[model samples]
Target chain A: MMRAVILAAPSVDALDNPALSALLGLIVITLIMTLGVMFATWYERKAVARMQQRLGPMRVGPWGLLQPIADTLKLVSKEGVRPASADRIAWDLSLAAIFVPAFLVLVAIPFTADWFVSPMDLSLLYILAVGGLSFIGFLLAGWGSDNKYALLGGMRAAAQLISYEIPMILSMLAVVMVVGSADVYRIILYQDVVPLIVWQPLAFIIFLTATIAELERQPFDIPTGESEVAGGVFIEYSGIRWSLFQLTGYVNMYAYSLLGAFVFLGGWEWPFGTDIGWGYQLLLTMVKMALFIVFFLWVRTSFPRLRVDQLMSYAWKVLLPFALAQIFLNGLVLVYDLPDVVLLATSGGGALALCWLVYSVVRVKPRQPLRMVGNVPATAPGSVSG
Target chain B: MPFEALLENYLAVFLATIVGTILVATALIGTRILAPYSKDRAKVTSYECGMVPIGRTRAQIHVRYYLFAILFLIFDVEAIFLFPWAVNVAQASHSAFWAMVLFIGILAAGLGYAWRKGVLQWNR
Candidate 1:
């Protein structure tokens, strides 16, 4: 009777050994990702400097490869200044709250076959959901600091993230519709034969644009536009607290690159059906990620900052509609037997055309330059418009 | 299970204990290295708009932020539950899907209720 009871209860040993291993593996991956973030900062500085025709950080170690390490040591040694009005507990907790979840998201990313920490069926959704948790940290930092600038920055980030999230998720849904699974591995496997980018090109474009905004990267970096807000939400943070935030940003950039590779660029899958070994596959994945990172840096150096309203409008009005249409088109393609290339090309072309039409209609006409609000005309003090 | 099996089963606990001890030691050392011992009137002054604060800086915030936080918690919990329900849907009968649809419908109704009540409204 006891044996039957034990059997019915589902033995704890039945939980599977691989599950435990996966959890440990995920922790290791997260650690590696954290290191990746530190390196990416160095990479970005060097890359951006190269674009500007200048030598970046070449003082610390060979070619300044250890610049991030030096930066981290300096930040660690510096004192963390807390505003007297600040909620100390909340401020301290906010750093952990932000950094931990960003680390946790790495677990859902697969590096190779049999390499994922937790093989979740809903890995993609899980990553998306957890990624939103960073906003809470931002809010906490803003509110906890009791500084108006920080508060405004935090609020802007929250609004920006929440707004971009809709289009981002919708774009991902287009991939899901094509692949019929939210599992990261499955999505990659589906991409093996033909990458989802081919079928969901519109979704790919929308996803890339929204993700750039989500990461608060160039063109969409109005939140941290130093000239306007004086460093935004991070103006108050100093020393290690500021370093942690910066670290989180770099890690998020890497995470986004990995996500792009998985969703659109056939993660760990070599082009032209070359069955590369696992080591080579990892190298390929890194190369693909580097290319995406370069693209990010390139855009940062190339484009001017987007106005807040324009950024929001692009996400909501432009990306969201096209993402929805792409999903619908994907559904139709799935239901019928059509030439895959033709279907994809037509859907992509249609989305682009629609976007162009909307763009033309909504394109802002250049207006007369505004007179400075406080500038008094030299000829007449009352003539504000002169 | 025998005592040996029980001991084997608890291997993870042993590993965690070792890791936890190392982490605690490192944290203590880090705190010692980083903490500043100096304190003075100027150092302790309340920071308020780059001026000495006139009144207590720790005033109570708006109650609506708390209300919204509570609402966020409720919805977050609902989302967490949906995960397991979603994973188990394939194992269940067709009724499971209908049941989920009904459940989600009710949740949506709650969201709508909150929206109508202005609980979800953020603007001051």
Candidate 2:
């Protein structure tokens, strides 16, 4: 069954027609993933609306199934505007920069054992390196736009992403430590009995939170905060260029979801010692990916946006310390020959405890009313202030 | 596969592609420069949304942006170093992990100092 699925993919036998096969595979995957992204958008709107007691996209296509498609068409047909002050070449390059790496990142992700295009030993590193490249694209988009808002958005995004990357990489290190290898396939294979989530719970939580921030998802989505920065780095983009940014965003969402599946949920692995066929394995993978996407949307709706300072502090102060502690604990577990389940439970509990402790410590206290020098009032009676 | 072999295969391909793209871009720019020799009064004039040229093509920008950029570079460069160190952590001695812990400890201290100094605060 696995062999058949592998053989069914056009890319599998494309060693004979390398270029043509690669192009075809690219098109197919792009279309499928695009559809997945479109559905994900609709799903998010509906889910969030339900959570908030409202209806979303009901008028589009049967509960807004076609809304994303409609939105895409509208965006494509819209007029593209270039500012007089903008750098045209960099502006165009920014779109390609943001998107190309996202496309390549998908290549390294394995949907199932045989379903992977080519299993490389360095898949995890490849993903991380490619993921980091998107920041260049984002930074260019902001700087090249020559708009204050765009520049601010881009800078904020750069700072946030660069800051959070520390805890994010550290969290992944915890996983790599337990798995004993950086290879995605080997990691999955190690999870044949129990997933890494069992042993590296803290790492899983930190990784997921940081990944969402890396993807610029909300509560950490100050980069594109509409109210504060007017759509952030994307404010200057229009027409197909804007669509490219949107497309990259959706692709990143899918890629992050797939990453979460591979690391924590145990890629293509069935729970409870059951051995399913290839078809069921593929289905299970999709289900896991969908569950992750829902998790992304759920968190977005449940939390308000974090202030920029708060976001940075959370990454550096909160997540970083806990990631360090978790790594230390994992080392202890390995040295002591503890059961995998025990290690997983204790690591996860430790992470949560550390987070709560950090949260309490970092909780901001209300500032005392500003004191005035001498007898002067802090503010005049009719004066307006922030 | 051995580590050396894997590195040779992937890194060689990656570097070759990057070099190829650079060569192609350079060739395109050279062709445009060597092929054209036309200059008109209109060509010398600045184009600003089809309006008359403004005072200057460049102006002073806010120093805050440069400050942020510098900070970003420092942290980004630090993050890059962590990647390889992380990959080799398993093979290294126990001292390596502790060294990393201390390294991160120093960086975290910097972050804390910046927070106290209001560098990370946005509203101000």
Candidate 3:
């Protein structure tokens, strides 16, 4: 009954008729994702432009609404080529490989209370597992291109992702521990009284950082670091092939924002304590997602990229410990039936303390350079290489 | 019926994924066919900062990254163990919570070993 359609009878019918619902949901979500990509591209440009005190995309259409279309057309018209030595199959498949997982996660996302495409009970797990597979596409892209830079990018991306995944899941586990279900809708329901962000700001921040790393966004985008590795995994791609990667990135950006909104900002639930219509419910969810998108854009424009090693350490030493603290503290709070303030104080204070401890420990050492075991010449008189 | 309903949900997800993939592929193919394609040896050759490409592209990878991968597999499996416990948190006993505590502690110990071994250090 919770799945009843909002605003009008049309959506309700779509929701009730299981077969028809799938078809309609596909169409709707596809349109939404495409439009989101278009809009996000423009939004990112404009936001970055304003940050630098300049106008962006003013000529094409009203507020440059047509910019993305022009960009897409340009991409399609450009020639996509493969290197002679490239793995043709993997090179060709990489675009779709990157694309498919993002869209699948989209299908699992709850757009609104009644407008969900597929409200799987295990939505969190499904989204995490499926979305996490995009790194494979990056790996394939790197390996397929037969370029050293691409391989480096791909490998760095793999490392970044592997390191970040631990903290990301650990942070999400805190929420799961509290809610007791991986179902996104159920998590939302548990937030009826209060959103998890208010309850666990530490986890929220950890997740935010982890997600940035996961998406390979600015400050964590070593995989596609343009200046260093020449577009990293995407070094060999051109034309529509390249655009597909861009599309996947933008769409997943929106998807992650949607996930963040659902998990932490209370999904379609109105924070203002108002019972709105279904159409408004959909709109509210969108608005929340849009806010998160802006936050992502703002952070992207503001921060510089972390060095590969620093990035890994940040995950393993800093965010990982905080995430673990979130779980341990939550367990204590649950078993002891401690007051809610205890949860807030311990998580917040614990995060600060852990940050300082990690920074102090890591900073003092100021990491040394790496050399292979055989590379070091033995200076000792008894050594073989002396 | 509900189980079928559940399956129907996943069916839609798979379908959506297919549709999205097809849409992208169609665009790529359309571009591939329509775009001007006049290639030379230079155009198709591998790129490396505009030089005659050196040796092999596939370099031997450092064991550091592989170490992270090995650790990821271990932790990811351990993380999966939480779902069952989390799915029924309402009736979780003191013992149930403590089990999680012990597990996390063991994981932390492993992490400590990694840290002490300089596995967590990036530049070194």
List the RMSD of every prediction in angstroms: 8.2, 7.7, 6.6
Ranked by TM-score from best down, the candidates are 3, 2, 1
Which structure is stronger by DockQ: 1 or 2? 2
Candidate 1 Cα misplacement greater than 4 A, ranges: A1-20, A270-274, A354-386, B1-32, B35-37, B40-49, B52-124
Q: Give the clashing pairs for model 2.
A: A198-A344, A199-A344
Candidate 3 A-chain TM-score: 0.87
Please provide, for model 2 over A34-55, each residue's C-alpha lDDT reduced to its tens digit, 9 standing for 90 to 100. Answer: 7887777788889989988999
Shift of residue A18 alpha carbon in model 2, Å: 6.0
Model 3 misplacement above 4 A:
A1-17, A354-386, B1-6
Per-residue lDDT of A356 in model 3: 75
Better of 2 and 3 by lDDT: 3
**Roughly what TM-score does model 1 have, to 2 decimal places?**
0.74
The models' CA-based lDDT, in order, is: 0.69, 0.71, 0.82
Q: TM-score (0 to 1) of chain B, per candidate?
A: 0.67, 0.57, 0.89
lDDT of 3 at A135: 81
Question: What value of lDDT does candidate 1 attain over all alpha carbons?
Answer: 0.69
- Runs in model 2 with CA error above 4 Å? A1-13, A16-24, A272-275, A335-342, A358-386, B1-124
- CA RMSD (A), model 1: 8.2
Full ranking by DockQ: 3, 2, 1
* Pick by DockQ: 2 or 3, better one: 3
